[model samples]
Target: MKISATILAAATLGSLFAAPALAQETLNFGIISTESSQNLKQEWVPFLAEMEKQTGFKIKAFFAPDYAGIIEGMRFNKVQVAWFGNKSAMEAVDRAEGEIFVQSVDAEGNPGYWSHLLVHKDSTLNSVQDVLKNAAELTFSNGDPNSTSGFLVPGYYVFAQNGVDDPKKIFKRVINANHETNAMAVANKQVDVSTNNSENLRLVQARQPEKFANIKVIWTSPLIPADPIVWRKDMPKDAKDKIKTFFLTYGVAAPGKSQDQVKKEVETLAGLQWAPFKPSSNDQLLPIRQLELFKNRNKIAGDANMSETDKKAKLAEIDAKLADLTKRMAALK
Candidate 1:
């Protein structure tokens, strides 16, 4: 009787302990909806499935409505791994203890992409400076405020030259949307000008040649860091290693002629090719860190619509925070 009772108690304790352990083994993956959700599911889904096969773990992807949501999901530990643009990746590194695991290399195997200022082929808009010079009379399209090439660099280029807060004050109106939408808007003649990444435009040209032919890039910004694949610092070491290994090896298999057809449908960006991913250090985010400071102080606060007093006050507060955050980010190096 004594033995029976002891055995029963031990079994109960074992089951209780096993519950949490079992739950922790399940993997959660995440990707940002910077592109359409349908596109993510259709194209990236297979890449993840292949990763799952290689790693021998069940991989489930969580798609966020926007970039900010994905960054927040990483912060709260709901998702274990994510893909982020340079600007949002910096935010993730700051807020979520995130570490970059890999970045997409070009077809030539280089890790860089550029920002492009796009206009209809027949439009007279010559340069970013020219657009700002005649701001109010022309129409403009911008990527979502959180976008890297779409918003950050383009906004900085215009504001830095104009020496003003709101570029819209000069333009008839500033339209904010996704890069693809902006490209489409410009091609359709819905807006006179817009900005997008070089890689995205390549994809557009490859997939929709006719539409892309109607648009041309009038200016290009300096290279932005390649988009990064990141993982939560808190994720298990073993799991992180497995994920890193899988992405690093994913593109190694050579595609046959038939595979070329598939590649055409899967990849939209021209130079972008799947290379093994490397873990990116937050150090790469330094440039964007500076850009963020400039944006908050000048762009956000300097909205021409806001009163001068309000703008100055907001700028002061942002300056203080940026100074402190910059110090901390530097310290991490």
Candidate 2:
């Protein structure tokens, strides 16, 4: 009787402890909504299905309205893994103890994309200078303020050059939107111009060709690094290893497939493919931080209370930091 009772007690405790591990084994995968919810899911389903098969863990998809949602998710531990742009990945690293482990490479083998300031093709605004020359007369749409290409690129280049912190105040009217909304607004002539990225433009070409045909890119910013895959620093070593191994080996066939075979297999998974990650670090974020630094320097330059000597000192400091950032950025190339 005593032996039977002890066995029952041990079994109950074992099951109680096992429940948490089983429940937590599922990864909460967070993604920024670069496409419609349905389309986004469609793109990821195959990739993640393979990821799960390889990693032996279930990944439950979590979608966010904007980048900030994923940042907050990581900060609060609601998400264990995420796909983040360079800027947002920086934010996650700073605020959420996140680490960048991998990045995507385009089919062209460039691990970068561009930010574009787009205007209606039929509009007379043919150049960025033309838009800046009449900033107050035009309606504009800047995508989410958290977005790097959608906000930071245009903010630092277009509005800062025009000496306005409140871009909305300078323009006749402004709308804060996501990439899709911005593309639609520009295509429909609902706004004179808007911010967009190369990735979203591809989606537009595929899903809304007529809209894509209507928009003309007025300016393209310097190549922004590709988005990164991030995971919490505190996650278990085994889980992290599994995540890295899966991504690094993901698209490339194991050394023997013909070019045709690889292409056909790759087409089945529509997500960007870069087999074997480059092993990224926070240095990947220097340019993004530099852009933020640009915004700060621009603001300081406009300060009326700072004397000439003080302004000179501050600008010098900013320039020195930028020099360091520039060197680090150039080294990565």
- lDDT of all predictions, in order shown? 0.70, 0.77
Q: Tell me the TM-score of model 2.
A: 0.84
Per-candidate Cα RMSD to the true structure, in Å, reads: 9.1, 7.8
lDDT of 2 by residue, 203-261 (tens): 88888998999999998888888878898787767667778877776656766546775
Expressed as tens digits, the lDDT of each residue in 186-280 for candidate 1 is 89999988888877787688778988999989888877878888887765566666677767655444344256634542353322344445556
Spell out the clash pairs found in candidate 1. 100-280, 101-278, 101-279, 107-271, 135-170, 135-171, 136-170, 203-268, 248-276
Best model number under lDDT: 2
Summed over model 1, clashes come to: 9
Query: In candidate 1, which residue ranges exceed 4 Å CA deviation?
Result: 1-25, 253-272, 297-333
Quick one: how many clashes does candidate 2 have?
A: 1
Q: Which residue runs of candidate 2 sit more than 4 Å off their true CA positions? A: 1-24, 255-265, 268-277, 305-320, 326-333
User: What lDDT score is found at residue 182 in candidate 2?
Assistant: 91
For model 1 the local lDDT of residue 21 reads 52
